[model samples]
Target: MEQPFQFKQFLIHQDQCAMKIGTDGVLIGAWTSINENPVSILDIGAGTGVLSLMLAQRCMAEAIDALEIDDKAYEQCVRNFENSSWGDRLFCYHASLEEFADEIDDEYDLIISNPPFYSPSLVSTALQKGENSMSDARKKARFQDAMPFKHLIESVAKLLSKNGRFSVVVPFSEEEQFIKLASESNLFPLRILRVKGSPSSEIKRSLMEFTFSNSKIQSSELIIETTRHLYTEDYINLTKDFYLKM
Candidate 1:
């Protein structure tokens, strides 16, 4: 069995999940704005419910809901949530974003996601016969076609409260396109944090926070390491609360 990822206040068992615990999820969970003191928070595509668990530990949100589409992932997510210290506050729903958005009338005060990031060409190749045979679980977890940017943005717009803020981490290359899609739904970017593996490496990811109303954008950059396995001060400071050895 895969060991659970031990955080300062919680543990996440991701043995059944297609995508294991990753830096992107941790970054979004820790970096998401809780300044509004949200009473309810939603985590879309919750794999092992790690993001929801993280939020529950970080804030006093009474309702921390997660939505997962994959069967195994959903089951693991629920199990992980139940095992956490804040089980009362964490709940997992096994449903696609579209179905959940259409059925649920309640709105969330805060939303977070580490969405799938495979490129279109790669997704196309995966679909072709005799190509690199990716498993169904991993396909759904990593391919954008499983939960397209337009669909995600539209669903989030409908499910978010008027003052709610949505935070997500996506490929830096998709930042421009994703923002355009979000703007179509009136979700303006409030902050953008570009992340690089090292100071010399190219930006690899974009952590973005959005809201209903437009405002002056707060843009910044983060380099995770100064050298191999050597974390940078900014990365450590930002994640010190959740990471055990920070």
Candidate 2:
């Protein structure tokens, strides 16, 4: 579990970061739209720098910035970026989204996040095993209070370029509320990808893309596996370029 995640073209060291590499970040990173060839990109709550690094591999974005609020995660993210093939173009900013939004004048042609989702009042089943097993920073990485959905959308609205697309991954149950929040900020959905763990499993997450202008919303579903450890064609096709085993 301590080993660096080896992508097809880059290596991510997540030892010090509270949040380790996971499917959610990888899904949004590989599924994010690159049709426009954005010149600049920003990743909010970039744990381990996986999403930013994925984009660095998929497109020639002149600059790719990642914002990580946790100090340990931020430092690890920076080290991961510097050790990557696109070191010069990648950067990690150690600041809250509100703080980062306050100081930056430039807008991102693309914005992304695999954000905090756990309810503040409810303890997660995994954490119940041993509440103290997880670090404080890791807890913040997954909890809404650290960066609530409202603030996340507002930050996206403020920093996203007029024509840019913002991509995010969240629990399926939160999709409508998340969209409503984004709509309030004038960011409308362009695409939605519902994701399931297996063909028979209920949808677990939504991979969404939004922009300032709207048209007909494109919608689809992605099943990650046919069975345990057996990848689906759609999932493998979506991430084959990045994941070595895919």
Candidate 3:
């Protein structure tokens, strides 16, 4: 059985979310820049509503909306949002990104997502395989499925307010493709941070932030740990507020 959920000072209750609270969410939450003090924010695919809660705590935004497609995750996200100290400012919707984008008339000042990055892959367990197959079948059936990377970038370009920013975490291998896709959609990359397990290890993930305006791209690297037993100072500093054991 899964362990009972826990709450941190900065994090509200986070239970019943298939994707548990983890370092990647914290990294993206901390790394995203809120230069304009966005009045409105959107968290796409907000599994546990952790990212939305973090933004609410970090910035003085007037409204924050979290979107989740999975029924269980959406319900959990709603519970987490309502239980948070900033419950009045936080809200969640049980809808896919495409559906939300289509219905949303007002543009968002900031948008963020830790998207579903896993491509089609085989699973070993029979139950797991069955679930994967069902999800895949569902995807294939929808003419207007949740936006692909290219479509996601395009939608962001259309939905972001002028001078707005979009931040996301994607696999390191997809960085080049994503950059190209964003460029094609007229969203220029403003900043990028390549994440590695350690200083000497290969890059594992990429956290990128983009803006509507054309600007010089800034790139940096983040090393999470020096060794398995030692966490890097920078890593700890970024997530200290959220991680209980950090």
Candidate 4:
């Protein structure tokens, strides 16, 4: 049997989840701004409930809710939340963002997501290139068509409190487009962090923070490693709270 992923304060069993725990989820979970002392939080597309678990460890948020659309992933997310130290504060909802947004009237003080990155164009291109290693379940978990960016942003706009903040991680290529989509809902970017694998690698991801009010956009970059397996100091400092070996 595959062993559960052991963190400093929690264990995650990802066998039932299509999208296993990954660096993007960890980065967004650890990189998200929680200094506002948000009383309530919501984790969209919560695969293994890792992001919610991380926030529970980092903040005193009394209510931490997670939304998972897939059947197996939803069950596993609930299990993960129950297995965590903050079980009392964590809850998982098994529903798509659209359904949840339409049914729930409660607004969150903080909302975060590590959303699907592969758009239809990218998927088509990859398929043409014979990059067929991904499974069906993973395609649902990683493809934009499964949870469109427009749908995600619109739901987030409705689900966030007037003073709430939303954070997310997306492909660096999608940064401009994502920001534009968010702006349509009046959600403006407050900060952005572009991430690269190494000093010589092209930017691959973007960590973004958005709010209802307009403000000066703070931009920065993060290079994860100086070389293979050698994590950068900035990366270490950002994620040290959750990673066991950091």
Candidate 5:
């Protein structure tokens, strides 16, 4: 069943997109810091324009652009942006990160994304064409297409202003690889938070923040729950402003 259109402190209407508003997007949006007080922001692969909206609510950026390659997702993102109070500051570009990075004239003070990371898995038949379109044309032709996490990071590095920040959320297993890739692009890790379901569970996701300069990195853990039905105080504190039922 489709969820109702709901509004939160930092999130606006986001119901029409295939990707509903979720914790991953919310966490990254709220957690990402603007150390230099960015004047411009870019959100790559913005499924429902949630990240951009959050940033708009939190910062007074001159312009906030969201790029989505998928047609349906792009359309929905535009709608979500238009409906928000910060609609004038937020704009949706129906283009992929590669294309946007190439044509955009100005660099961003902050670049963020919740990239597609599923790799070497069985894709559903219904999404085969969409998956193929996301893959590099040459790689798709060779049947070696994979989610382009590296490409995303490299593009971000090119489009970020000096002293800018890049933030993302990826699976815990990919944190090391992601850090290595970002380093190659001259984007060094500044902070990392490992997220686990419970105290005893393995870390399932990592929220990472990087910058153009090499800074002393801070690492920490976030346990979402103390039990199946109970959320940890820290988790609640982090998300209380954005979750309606919290």
Candidate 6:
């Protein structure tokens, strides 16, 4: 059965995808900077192609390309892309980041990723609690070994255009290590957003953006909910246009 996620502008068919659409993808997709009027964009590990679709709807970027490694997710992402209004301008490549980077010599003006966060050796709380059943696709979607930060940063260094921008979302605790790895590849932080579930809750996720230059970093915080199922005004404002009921 294909469970479809309803968005304001487009519906995403994601039953075949192990990693369904979640707040992290939406947060990074909506929060990533796009002011430069990029002519081409790339979505790394695009799950259901939501980020590419959102950017296509939000900007005039003529080319929105996505890369996915998982067999099922890649097919679903292609289906989602072709079903969208921007199908003529959108395309999906069924390949790993390394494979895509190795084959393609073109640079992207904007590249975005909501990469797998947990290391292959670690199990997430959701997995331990039985909330998410671990599978090959899910593991490949969330494991560090599947797409290491070092590999991702190095690819960005080579694939991103000189004036391009790159963005991603990962666990807040990994922020320091992720930035350090990026700096080694000469990709400096441009903006950082630390996200919390509630005002009193500990920081949960970090949404980061980078570029080739060592520009002044813009840092900030985002609280998604003031209480369970109740969103903050800022959160509402940031994602209102895309979420059906936001």
Candidate 5, which segments miss by more than 4 Å at Cα?
10-16, 121-147
The total of clashing pairs for model 6 equals 0
Name the best candidate (by lDDT).
4
Global lDDT of model 2:
0.90
Candidate 5 vs. truth: CA RMSD? 4.9
* lDDT of residue 45 for candidate 5: 80
Question: How many backbone collisions does model 4 have?
Answer: 0
Tens-digit lDDT track of model 4 for 21-104? 889999999989988999999999999999999999999999999999999999998998888789999999998898999999
Each candidate structure's count of clashing pairs: 0, 0, 0, 0, 0, 0
lDDT to native, each model:
0.91, 0.90, 0.80, 0.93, 0.79, 0.90
What candidate 6 gets wrong by more than 4 Å, as runs, is 120-133
Model 1 ranges off by over 4 Å: 121-133
Q: Return whichever of 4 and 6 wins on TM-score.
A: 4
Give per-residue CA lDDT, model 2, range 1-246, as digits (tens).
688889899998999887888899889999999999999999999989999999999999999999997888888999999898899999999998999999999999999999987755445654676764767777777777788899999999999999999999988988999999999999999999999999889999999999999778999999999989999899999999988988
The lDDT of model 5 is: 0.79
Against the true structure, what is each candidate's TM-score? Answer: 0.95, 0.95, 0.86, 0.97, 0.86, 0.95
What tens digits encode model 1's per-residue C-alpha lDDT throughout 131-168?
Answer: 35767788778888888889999999999999999999
Backbone clash pairs for candidate 4 read none
Clashes of 2: 0
lDDT of 4 at 158: 99
Which of the predicted structures, 3 or 4, would earn the higher lDDT when compared with the native? 4
The lDDT, on a scale of 0 to 1, for candidate 6 is 0.90
Weakest lDDT window of 10 consecutive positions for candidate 4: 125-134
* lDDT winner, 1 or 2: 1
Q: Give the clashing pairs for model 2.
A: none
